[model samples]
Target: MSEVPLPYRVTRVRPETADTVSVALAPAGEESLAPFMPGQFAMVYAFGVGEIPVSVSGIGDHELEHTVRSVGAVSAALCALRPGGRIGLRGPFGTGWELGRAAGRDLLVVAGGIGLAPLRPLVTAALAAPHAYGRLNLLVGARTPDDLPYAGQVHAWSASHGPPYCQVTVDRPAPAWRGRVGVVTTLLNGAAFAPGNTTAFVCGPEVMIRVTARELVHRGLAPHRIRVSLERNMRCATGHCGHCQLGGVLLCRDGPVIGWDRAESLLSAREL
Candidate 1:
């Protein structure tokens, strides 16, 4: 398919957190947007304005979804549009969190704030095929209770079966909230997994990814077994633009989903 943006009609919009909204899209064609793997992102365009890369927040047997935050001119424009609006989309780009590596092994997923959007599909896919992986875990953290995205779903996952064993934390908690309080890394202390057999997937702020990966390593997960979705780096969702370049890595092509061993040096030296 062409990297040029494809026309997509907004089918529905649902506010996630205060600043985030989940928009469902359907391409203006018989082909529709291509099926995307978890952790892959699409370059979403708001007509008349520019475009930005947004992660796929939710996906199932039907709708294509994007959980976008109105943080900039183009993104805000994309968010303000209503359900009947039209947008442009390209990609399903970047390397996705290849969950097959974790098959028959422990899988740990960690997210921070909106970072959970890209990781949600991984969770849904894992749950649908429970016997494929040894254990499933999800840990998420946000600035505050009100900042947590997908709150209801998180609650459901936490209350579900043995694997997935979900845990959520907030930097600060509202008096009305009764969940754990602290940065996401704090939850790692109570995480139950044999580090040696664990394949960990982390997506969050640069600092959080570092801290969490270090914690996972301290507990025994090998660097190669750790996968991370880098911040949605892009200009051209295809690698030609170089705007999202990090030394030898072109985030749009080489990653977005990069192994800790492959990215540790770059994440350490640069402003990823």
Candidate 2:
């Protein structure tokens, strides 16, 4: 991973929602960093604006994709970029989903809002090698129908009538919305899995991760079998910055992805 960001040219930008855009990038020069795994992230620099850790939403040959939500200045700059726009990127940083460990076991993916971005590549890999794993299940939640990204693709996965039995729920519904409505955990009751032989990957708001992990454990899934992605306050991708520290763990290096067993107590403790 190069600490000095490499120039990446935006090849395409597709608006996913009112305030979010999916930007596809390719190396602007012969220098490419490294291949990014499913759960890893990159520090995207928007020139004079700043940089932020954004998980790789999609990975392809000599290309990278980021689903940026325009909630702050840096992210807004990324969202505003059009085709041919240039930005700086560094990494293939942090732990990945490590799907190999789950070989021959059922797979469960739970994502909330933008959290789906990080988990998308994992789902795609599982789908690509369906026979390598047992069953694939996906549960997603968003604030509203409009707030959900990858609406078309998600439904397409669900419509496949094969592995990755997908279900989506929303906190609130729009006038024409006709899907289930509630928190993401609500879909857990209907997800197909053999708790003992299943491995789950979850990402979202911390609260959603907590409740979802708890529910999975309650249904007999081992805490260690449940992995979660925590963004925290990762300013520096390297561990030197204490901004992303959670208890004894530095999310930037130690995680962004970690086992629920390691996170349960830390999350329950009150932060001073």
Candidate 3:
């Protein structure tokens, strides 16, 4: 098969939270853009710095956006690029959290810190087809209330009793904050989930994923039903580079998203 070409041009770049910025890009011309499943990510390349994989944060009319936090050299460079700057993009890759499987069932999304990026596309997709799913619960956690993403949108989602049930938590609460306080896991206690019919998607730091996954399982979610998005050092979006190999799995190619059962080995393996 021929290689898929990168066809994105920066349309707008705006900050979403303290450390994260949202970038919107559209197709360069008449060429059509590839459709992506929620929870999939695109590999973004900055000419001189390098290429890094980032999740699609929002999809707009004629554009797709990515939420990126300044975490490393390449990311800092991405944050520095102005609107209209040229950047390379290569995906919508990885096995996404399958929305089809959750159809007619409840959907639970748990995100911590920057982990919210990958979950955004899934939320959008779910909301678009509200009738297909039973209930949609989104629980997000951040270092502080100010670090939350899509604050206004999340609030509106929560107000509705249907699919998009949104809730937020913070490690430390400001005086004005009235939402749940403590880790994201703490909020799970009172939430109602139909374990047998519900599928949960989690993305966060390793420790947070571990703790959250444990809680989900304890709440009766099947180990295999829990999907998680994993992060590692990636140099090439293709599997040629060895930078992102964890155990026998190549994160860039095999996943960024994997089922809990499949990831169990690596999650417990040493130096993965």
Candidate 4:
């Protein structure tokens, strides 16, 4: 992961929600950074504005995608970018979801709101190779129907008729919404998987991750088989900055994705 950002041009810009946009980028010059893994993040520089760590939502040959929510200055700048715009990008940083470990085991994916962005590629990979894994289940939740990103893509995934078994819920429902309504964990009751044979991937608010992982453990899944993605005030993608430290681990360098066996105590610390 180079500290310096490389020039990239926006190839496509699509609005996902009122405050979110998915931007596709390609190398502007000959040089191209190494491919990013599913759960890894890139430091995206919006010209004079500044840079922020954005997870890679999709990855292809010499191409990348980022789903940005307009939460702050840097994110808002990214959301406003147009198709022909230019930006700077660096990295393939931090640990990835490591899907290979789950081979031959059932796959469970849980996401809350924008957390789905980083896990998107993992789901796509699993779907494409149905024979490589056991049953696949995806549970997603958002504040409201409109708050959900990749709504159409998720709908298509669920409509595919089998295997993936996608389900969605909303904390607050709109008048036109007709799906389930509740926190993400509420949907787990219907997910089909044998606890002993399952490997789960979870990403969301810290509280949601904690609750989901604990529930899975209570239902007989081993803590070591559950993986979670975490985020903090990560200023530098390298370990030099202590901003993203949780307990003794630096999220940007050592994590962002870790097994529940290792993350449980760190997340439960009273003075992290």
Candidate 5:
């Protein structure tokens, strides 16, 4: 049963941007989906089409949400399914961002484009209990104002509490756009974290991961303390197929989240 797909009924479909949708699903049966920590993903099957790995964007009281961008055949079919429709789901798989390892220290979250999806649950976890960690900084980068997801929540998180702040930048901004415009690293200058005591979780395109990790290291955050999520290396949701390889790690089972010290060499090389 663990290897087979289970049914999940789509309960909500939220339009995050022009091309992106956040699909919320609930178990089709009485059994509840197993709980998942932030950074974990599930293999979603689109019935007639195929299956793809999607990260858990939000864990609601009765549902699990994944932010889907219709990038290809499988994803487009997944995103096209309406509420009340059913799709196949399996897993809350892979290693999560072990927050315990970063306990009592500053948490810096850097996300690019849809990469923010995987990190959303962690933001919720940290902000709900603000007393556990030091300063919490969320830095997000998007291609344009039109492409940014979590628009409403991003504003709310930055405004809510003093210690947790969210800074966003875009590669291109339209006229009258008010926020900063630059790569995500530009916001690093104003981020409040003592390099020695900060733990960073980064996710995005490999280039962005490489640049962001390099920036964090240049600022003195321990290379080992910087964690990154790799999507390029995760083709199959389970390691059984043996296709997803990021350097020596089998991303489906061993990673998708790896330490900067371990990922740096692989990321810089580009093709592995």
Candidate 6:
């Protein structure tokens, strides 16, 4: 394997949604950064605030962008950084959404709140290769309408991308809103899922994953067909620090994306 790149300088920052901002980084002495899989995350090191893991929100031929929300200390620091500020980056690590398996089958994506960050890459990758799958449905749930990530892009994708569907739900709706007003699961009630031939990618909080996984299984999806992206404290991307250990599995290495059956024991364990 090649050595990971070091810190890069922030070249530009753009806001995607109300609470989310996309940061563009330029590698030292270079105009571009390495390409990464859609769902991989980079270990970002913010000066004086320590390091944290953030998912890559978008990638271009020349710039690497990350869509981040102000949820914790590191994120808050990231939100406060000005353009031209320097920050360290380690990876593009972890297993990503299994795009190959999604080929020729219906693809259902369920994302909650900032969980949309990881899924955004998978969506972009799939859309770029339109014929790789059958019908594609994206059901997103946020705290409110303003909390939805990539709102404009989601609308555009729904409009021009085949029969692709995008539905958004919010726990609280604005007065002028016409979309669903409830948990994301509520939006799944009447939707059709071809479990036998479909694959589902779910990323969100633990509670959301639990509920979503149960519903998918109830809808006849095999345990192995449901892939989830899990989050935990990670000190190293290479599984050296032991911060992301879950039973015999080290989330940093074994997966951030894991099949339901493979995660059964870990997810069921009391302390994991």
RMSD of each: 1.4, 1.0, 1.9, 1.1, 1.4, 2.3
Segments in model 3 whose C-alpha atoms lie over 4 Å from true places = 1-7, 159-162
Task: Please list the C-alpha lDDT of all candidates, in the order they appear.
Answer: 0.86, 0.92, 0.82, 0.91, 0.87, 0.80
Q: Which candidate has the top score in lDDT?
A: 2
lDDT for model 4: 0.91
Candidates arranged by TM-score, highest first: 2, 4, 5, 1, 3, 6
Winner on TM-score between 2 and 5 is 2
TM-scores of the models, in the order given: 0.96, 0.98, 0.93, 0.97, 0.96, 0.91
Report the alpha-carbon TM-score of model 1 versus the true structure: 0.96
Off by over 4 Å in 1: 270-272
lDDT of 6: 0.80
Model 4 lowest lDDT segment of ten? 155-164
- Which digits, one per residue and each the tens of the lDDT, describe model 1 over residues 1-272? 54678888889998888888889988767666678999888899888889898889877655689988889999899779788899988877888899987889988999999889999999988988999998788999999988888888897777776567999999988999888989998888777888888999999988999888888888888998999988644788777877888778888888889999888888888655
Lowest-lDDT window of 10 residues in candidate 3? Answer: 1-10
Local lDDT at 23 for model 4: 98
lDDT of 5 at 220: 96
Question: What lDDT does candidate 3 reach at residue 211?
Answer: 88
- Tens digits of per-residue lDDT for model 5, 1-272: 34777899999999888888999999999876688888888988899888888889998888999999999998898778799999988888888888778889999999999999999998888878788899999999999988889888886766776556888899999896798999999999988999999999999888898999999999999999999998853445677677787768888887778899998888777477
Candidate 6: misplaced stretches above 4 Å?
Answer: 1-5, 16-19, 31-34, 157-163
Instruction: Name the best candidate (by TM-score).
Output: 2
Clashing pairs in 1: 136-164
Weakest 10 consecutive residues of candidate 6 by summed lDDT: 155-164
